[model samples]
Target: MRLNIKSSILFALLVSASAINFSASVPDEGMFPLSELHKAGLKKAGLKISEKDIYNPGQIGLVDALVRVSGCSGSFVSPNGLIITNHHCAFSAVQLASSPLHNYLQNGFVANSYEQEIEARGLTIRITDSYEDVSKDILDAIAKTDDPIERIAIINKKKAQLVKEAESKDPSIKAEVSEMFIGKTYVLFKYKTIEDVRLVYIPRQDIGEFGGETDNWVWPRHTGDFSFLRAYVSPDGKPAKYSKDNVPYQPKKHLKVNPNGVEENDFVFILGYPGKTFRHRPAQYIEYQQKFLLPYTSELNDFQNQRMLEAGKNDKATELALATRIKRNANVMKNYRGKLKGLRNIDLIADKQKEDKALANFIQSNTALKAKYGTLMSDIDKHYQLVFTDAERELWFNNLYTGIRTYQIANLINKLKIETAKKGTLAQKNEYFNKNIALVKKELDAVYESYNVDADQKIAAHMFAQAYNLKDKNVIQTIANKNFKSADAAGSYIAQNIANSKLNTKEKLYNEVLNNAATLLAYDDEILKSQQQFAHEHAPFNQELTRREGVLNKLMGDYVAVKEIYQDKSFIPDANSTLRLTFGNIKGYSPADAVYMKPFTTVKGIIEKGNSGDIDFRYPQAIEQAWLDKNFGAYTLKGTNDVPVDMLYNMDTTGGNSGSPVMNAYGELIGVNFDRAYDATINDFAWNESYSRSIGVDIRYVLWIADKIDNAQFIIKEMGI
Candidate 1:
């Protein structure tokens, strides 16, 4: 007999007999969990080394060498904790260490000794120590809660308890509860976090990002996108924050660099923390992304990029301060554009809709299946309708408050007021109030440290213009009341008001927050009033959206359960920024008919792009001279006289996989995974072996640059080349 929804919804939705079978056919998909490596058929897929070499759970393996550098991935290259990651991953550190007199971001940075290595502020690296399945604990705790919100609350409490229990065993360990399958499976991953990370090497901007945005996600790339950092610990070999007393950390395992890169069709694999993917989402979710999310986000990012460019055009300090933000936004903006194009090119939504229809038919054809999942399709569609109804208005209001600092401060103040007035126990209210108050102060500190009024005003103006042009202008009561004649007028009005506000500075706003909390909600600033109006208008929708998300989470879990039965296979869990391994071979694809792309690119391509006179393609002078002189070092391939710059493979990777080590069959580092082919940006939605090609900077290129251009032979020698 089947169980009722009230008793075992999550349990039934998760652990069917078929789902328990881990040994499914090894498809060219999935960011396989470390625990699942034995079943991943790595050996049959040309892994020359044993599976234990990659992930030996209780003992140290290559997995211990992997590091999550903030949001990107890296690998320890030496016993003393030398790390190799992408240049963009280390760009912020270089920016922090740069100035007009010593511009490391432009001229490059190289530490001659450990004493010279600069501290990388706010940079932390976490190594995965262990993970355990806690699905039964989480699912059983919430098994009886039928109310969606209450069920979610119970889940959170259970996850927190598990994490706290895990972290209790070691002070240096940081524990996280990752949802492997939404609302179904959970895992507790423990990490050893290193806080005293320092910058070791970074090439000049021209050499590091040779093609810039123009070639960011395209194939046949020629960017030497690599950098190095070192992790340090206290004298007693414990994790500690940056200090003069800290010594270099010595890891039990480190990846050995292979000077000779891969040949065509040689096997390669990446080990890193990959971010989110939505392959199993329903048709309506795909529709939402295709119709609303992707385009909207891309356009907003582009607008912000252009505004920042205009604000920093002449000021060198402003330019340097905004460089990281601009580069990050442009990267996302272009990636989203690629994803949107891929969606339309493949008609993903239409295909998903047809599949949904087929699933509904299959369910209806069987009495038992119909009784279990009769309203699944209709229920999912209903929730999506709620999401789509006010998405535009909500998106505009979200950007207004988040993109502009003044509005962000106003919103925080409003939140604090609400928190203060809430009816709760003294301890509860104090904890909540303190948290909100800290948030307000942090925002203030940030604004005081780096807020650019000109840039903020321009961004605010652009956002107001966007809001005014929306079909439902009443979503923002302030703009609606103004009745501006045109988008330009709307933009100019907001900018002028922001410029004239007395509470624009951090000191003034923070004073109000600290001294005048009782009357803070009624602050007289125009921007504050407008922000309150936006909050009032958006509150109902936000609440309903939360409830809808909870409901959909449960429904999607059930849908996947039934869908797996229908498909006769269990799908790989979507990536949730957990450490995973993906393997493929070194090969290329045909982006268009009659045009086959080669797997490898050489320094010749870099010089060719530089000759075009595009600043984005400019190479370093030493690179050009080295090419002209035919000064190929041992880093060059054995058979070919040319030195390799970048290579392509068919690996499954996403956002957080940046800077991951591209390892050859022997588990040696051969390249650094950075970008994906333009056609492969759709891999997040659906993976196609023919078109899903990932790009990485060849290790040979990194050695050549470190040896010939930057003269950092110490780094090469340290790698034991």
Candidate 2:
């Protein structure tokens, strides 16, 4: 059994990141963790079932049906590990299995039998077994040191030890300790990881992504946005990697799909692993996002998207390979634009300022509070001031390392040289090479499989030009090793490096570069030499940022404590990729003075959009014909041939909530949550019921597509519909 070095490193880093955490929530603003569900007032808020039915400690319950499908949330809908999630969540797998001959991304996929299901490479699922609070242990360990860096080290070491102890009891478990609130609380979550996930059904792009970028975060959407998958385990009911001997995993519980979905004002809720939210941060943090982060990332993403488009022009294989990356970049670019708009539209910074001022006054009025929190706001402001000081320079170095493939490979080679030098004996060096050479080859193979040199060079040149525009000329001069009179000069230098470097092409990377790493390190290859220089210059700045984060963590924890006292309530912490419960009534909101968006969209909406001249709106002829023929079957809304396509609710959600099961009062699946309305994009900063509606494909629509259009009746029967 070989070690999975990549998985091990990722697990360690994630465990360490658990030290910093966020917010307090009112009932409506809360994505309440399962341990805190008792405070959510479920029955009082119209739950038809008991609380224990949703989460029963030491027993299987509705929460047992939930699973984390990669970054998104999903649920078991059948006794045999049949899982349902968003189409975009499974898009990469479909893209991987696709080709010009049988493009699954365009034509859709249906595995009529188990044998036909394609292996979903790099996609895995996790069922959370249990969680326990470990806040006291971590805080106590850190209390010995006031030095910020030392404190961070202590906390990380404590978390690692706890995870190791937990996993030692069971080899099948993957344990993680997540921060619930920065410097304040921590929880250890145990998950059963199944690596053999397969794609069972996925709709064509015309159906899954109808209206494409235009309707992505908009309301009254007609997109299906749903897909089906299956999870498999070893025959003896243990987690294992993909293999022929694996069988479908049988979960202790599964969700019951309700054909009769929700109506206006129906009670609804979601259970999912909602991603990060900054609702509790100080006003200065919001200022940082508004001023720099959002704009810079959005613009960079847009630039990359255009380069990809140009690279794939008239090349089918290139287009197929870049499909997923292009789609993901476009989605994020547009999402950030919306978030910027939403931040201004809601005046979020001004609102946060008002809250901060009120809290300040409250502290001044109480002698004890003043004593404890006198410098809290000031310290937080100071941290941001430091962040803003060198933000532009830091941004350049960060993106250079993260955004360039050649730079990454160069860094890895440099690392290998350092490690090899540490080995004092020939035998030890040989042992290292034997263990790692195969992994290096595997990584380089993947890089070449999707490599587009021309487009990437353009992107790299663009980034260099952008950095050269900074007001501080000395830093750029130091980095480039020369003074440039114009940004184009800087860009041209990097473009030349990328084009003429010895390791620019696959053959050169393997034979001249990877095979002779020591010679390249001792001598100077243009690309590797420049990358090493950048790494050397970046070391101090990165260290400073880490120290600042440690100090900020402690400051924010104090802020949380003081805010809790000021509000006189025990609040639900913000989401940090942990399982949580958020409930709200099915409703809609007005985005403008005269506009009132409806809560439900029907199949008629799909045809209306399809008739538009936009290619994104063009649907399959079969779908339009099915609508004209009134082929909605039993899935139609009562008293009409209309089938609800997508519905809106005000449930609090964020990025990782995609594919979370939307359940009715009785805890039966009613929909699959996918996106939030454009206005709700700002919810991550601050959420209010007025414009925080979430969108989901109604379950009736999911069933109708499987039964009437795709003819995947086996999925219908397996869901016990």
Candidate 3:
């Protein structure tokens, strides 16, 4: 039937509005697996390469170039196993390799040759070899178990067996079975682990961590958060521990870096292991976070960071030791603060409830769906209510145990008691004791290195004050009442205990505590007694919470299956530290009214933000001179002649995605994904395309630092530039 001109215009408007609404609602979502990229609408999203070009189990692809760098992501930039990742990803190694004289963390390091590369002890890199769907195998193994706990045990056993068989095939291969969509699907990932990793190059802290906490998660970022590491292997090309005889391992595929750099609206994609996200979680969870969890956590994190900073002041060794931990805590605190703000700004609970209502209406319209999925949302809400009820006590117990040294000592003592109770021969018992004693001593040494009695005491006092002020009936208040009249008195008592305790020193912990396990077990201390009482009081709540979580996971798994069936929509599983591909374009965002954040920031921003008095803003003299001289060399942008420091993209990312390779349409390395904008931290809970933007260190800035500042020509040549 033909329509009138006016009717046709109205119809066209309706269709256009519908399309815009759909686009706005969905955003550029999904952290798809390599095999599912095609189905994820990659081509329609402007992917110029085939899915196979990014990942192929049977052949070398972009996946081969990716590596899991400790807890972060990295990509091979050279055939000789040179990897590029965020400097913060390698921060621990840098700190470990630093000392009063060398101070790698402050000065950075540049290896002119392979021989000069410093060994990164305890660092390992893993490359994905293969992955396969193991959902049926896991489901079958747990099919007979109706109890959630028993089902988990059965699934874990099956997973262990699978990993054992896979690893037994090759000693160098590490295997893991990761559950996706709660438990609806499972995939076994096999990786070739290279243990001999070495630090190749790192820019100074002034460049690497520029602007520090002040500019973290903010736009117009100028941080050159990039570093290089090389993977080494034995003579026969097998993974081995650090050795003098080891050589740089050759990778099957390495990314060809495009030093020419990317412009705004350029197609960008990322392949890495994202840590976690709760985009599919029920509305109750969002409500709980908004009302309670995020604010409380942020407060605790702030307290802890302040204590650490106060303790580390004027002590270089202590500062170096606490640097990594302080950075982590500060990052988390900022993230929680951002998340809380974003949650309130977006009215996430109302939006989630609206979505839930629509889903419920759809289910109610169909008989089978009504019967199968009608109670899912309510069931989730019910479980969340229980969680909220026990959260206060749980928070108290967790904070006391985590922040107090005495509580940790109590745990160690209890572990030692359990070890002594085990049945074994005298020699075997002695062997176990010696082995465990070494471990205990190592742990005690680390604790002592970072621990400050005054700081811990202050933290303990704060915790007690919080519990007392809230009139919490938890063990914290009970202990406070028994030991002292007020939180200040409680703090003083804990401080005295910390100062007098033998556990304060490693030598005392070993010779006095470890060598006399029986004596330690029989000893009575106020801190230890308080820890025991706290654990006893919280045990039931902890057990119930675990059971509730298991049940909730199963329910969520069922809900996912039902939604997929009824809605006929693609259900990408929540991230669980597994490899996934997310694609988007370099784009700016409007964070607030009339405030447009451009996708890219140049070196000019760095200079503008620089302050010689602040360590974070201070640059090396060479870098300053080069910038003044306009020595961008080949790293300059074509028309503007400016070196891009960082760029923003709309790709989905999380914690572990730091250092992830930001690639062009053809899968060439262009940047490194490091941090997301502050307003986008809520992407973990819910994604709003207008606010969710991930930032990356532009490759051109990295090269500019290498060539113009550090004069690392050999490293540049090694990339075959």
- Highest TM-score model number: 2
lDDT of 1 by residue, 1-721 (tens): 0001122221122464433434434338878876667878888889999998887645667887889999999999998889999999998778877887888888889998999999987689998776667788888898887787787778889999988887887666898998878877877777889999998999889988889998999988999899999999999999999999999999888999999889998989999999899998898998888888889888988988888888779987878777887888899888888999899999999999999999999999989999989998999999888778777776776676557876776666666767665836655655666656776777666544445678788888888887777775235666777899998998898788788765567766666545544445445667767777777777876776667767977988888888888887777788888888999899988989899999999999998888899979987888989988989888786567889999999899999999999999999999999999998888889988889999999999999999999999999999999
Candidate 2 residues 1-721, lDDT tens each? 0011111211121122332222333337889766546657787778899888898666677889999999999999999999999999998888888899989989999999989988987689988876677877898898778888888888899999989998998677888999878888887877889999999999999999998988888888999999999999999989888888899999989999999998988889999999999988988889888888888888888888798889889898888888887888888777788889998987788988999889889988989878878888888888888888777777677777546666766676667766765766766765675577678777766655555777778888888788677775226544456576777887787778878875567787667755543543353466777787787777876788789888998998888888877876555677899888899888988989999988999999888887778888988888888899998888887656799999999999999999999999999999999999988888888888898999999999999999989999999999888
Residue pairs with colliding backbones in model 1 are: none
Q: Model 3, range 1-721, lDDT digits (tens) per residue?
A: 0001211211011111231011111236777766555556777777788877886545778888889998899999898999999999998889889987899999999999889999885478988776666766787787776786677667779999999988998666898988776765677777888999999998989889998998898887999999999999999999999999999999988899888888888888999989989877778889888877788878987998899798889888878877887888789889999999999998899998887777778778889878877787777778888777757666767667667765776677767656865837656656666667767767666566656666777777777667655543334445654656676776666667767776556666666766754555555566666666777767776777667766776777766666565555545667878888888899999988989998888887777777547666877788777878888898886667678889999988988899999999888899999999999899889876778899999999998899988888777888888
* Per-candidate TM-score against the hidden true structure: 0.92, 0.94, 0.91
lDDT of each: 0.83, 0.82, 0.78
Order of models, best lDDT first? 1, 2, 3
RMSD of 3: 7.7
Candidate 3 wrong stretches, greater than 4 Å: 1-27, 421-431, 469-484, 516-524, 611-615
Model 3: number of clashes?
A: 0
